[model samples]
Target: MRALGGLWDTTRGMTVLRDAGYTPNEKHVRRTYRRLAEAGLLTKVQDRPVQYRVESGAV
Candidate 1:
């Protein structure tokens, strides 16, 4: 997820994943972000665009 930068939304996340050689769609990106948030590695900051902030020490 660090490939996504400190702050990102689903669209950027998909690009990051794709660049990393992963086949990702919007659903996959959202799911991955949700999992990261649940693990405390990320925090959801917006709902419309599904923005997220990387947690401190997550890098």
Candidate 2:
């Protein structure tokens, strides 16, 4: 999640994560975000391309 901190949303987050040397399967990344959202640690803002914001204090 620290890798995702400065990113605008998940697509950028994944790109940054990859660039930072973290490699999870694409489906796993998406699923992890979904789980985070369900747990209220993240909030989905848009569906097209799937954008999300980490909840306040989530870090």
Candidate 3:
């Protein structure tokens, strides 16, 4: 989704989910990102805390 369009931190996704009226916790955010990466919707950045981004120019 738009939240993962660029290099995004998982915490930021939690914030986005919260702003959208969902009470997603850290685990939910991580799971979502992992799944998206597996599904090729996101590319995972191998950082300590990890980061994910959608393909360039992708929606």
Candidate 4:
């Protein structure tokens, strides 16, 4: 989520994707993030509001 300065929650991430001309569904977005976290590309850094951090050097 470089558009979000590398840390983002679902709502903001979806907005960024929309701004970039992608109309991704919410479930798809969440699933993608889940996959990224599973793949070690992202880290779940917050619970409330559900924020995540990009792994170091992941950009």
The number of the candidate with the highest lDDT is 1
RMSD of each: 1.7, 2.7, 2.0, 1.8
lDDT by residue for model 2 (2-59), tens: 4445434556656767998997566777887888899888888888878777777775
Candidate 4 structure quality by residue, lDDT tens digits, 1-59: 64346677788778978998999887888888889999888899988878788887676
Candidate 1, residue 30: how far the Cα is off, in Å: 0.2
Top TM-score model: 1
**Comparing 3 and 4 by TM-score, which wins?**
3
Compared with the true structure, the alpha-carbon lDDT of candidate 3 equals 0.79
Q: Which ten residues in a row have the lowest lDDT in candidate 2?
A: 1-10
Task: List model 1 lDDT by residue over 1-59, tens digit each.
Answer: 66546678988888877888999889988898899999999999999977999887886
> 14 in model 4: Cα distance from truth in Å?
0.7
TM-score for each of the candidates:
0.82, 0.66, 0.81, 0.79
Instruction: Sort the predicted structures by TM-score, highest score first.
Output: 1, 3, 4, 2
Query: Candidate 2: where is the Cα deviation over 4 Å?
Result: 2-10
Those runs of model 4 whose alpha carbons end farther than 4 Å from true positions after fitting are 2-4
Candidate 4 yields a Cα-based lDDT of: 0.82
Question: What does candidate 2 score on TM?
Answer: 0.66
TM-score of 1: 0.82
Model 1: worst 10 consecutive residues (lDDT sum): 1-10
Flag clash pairs in model 3: none
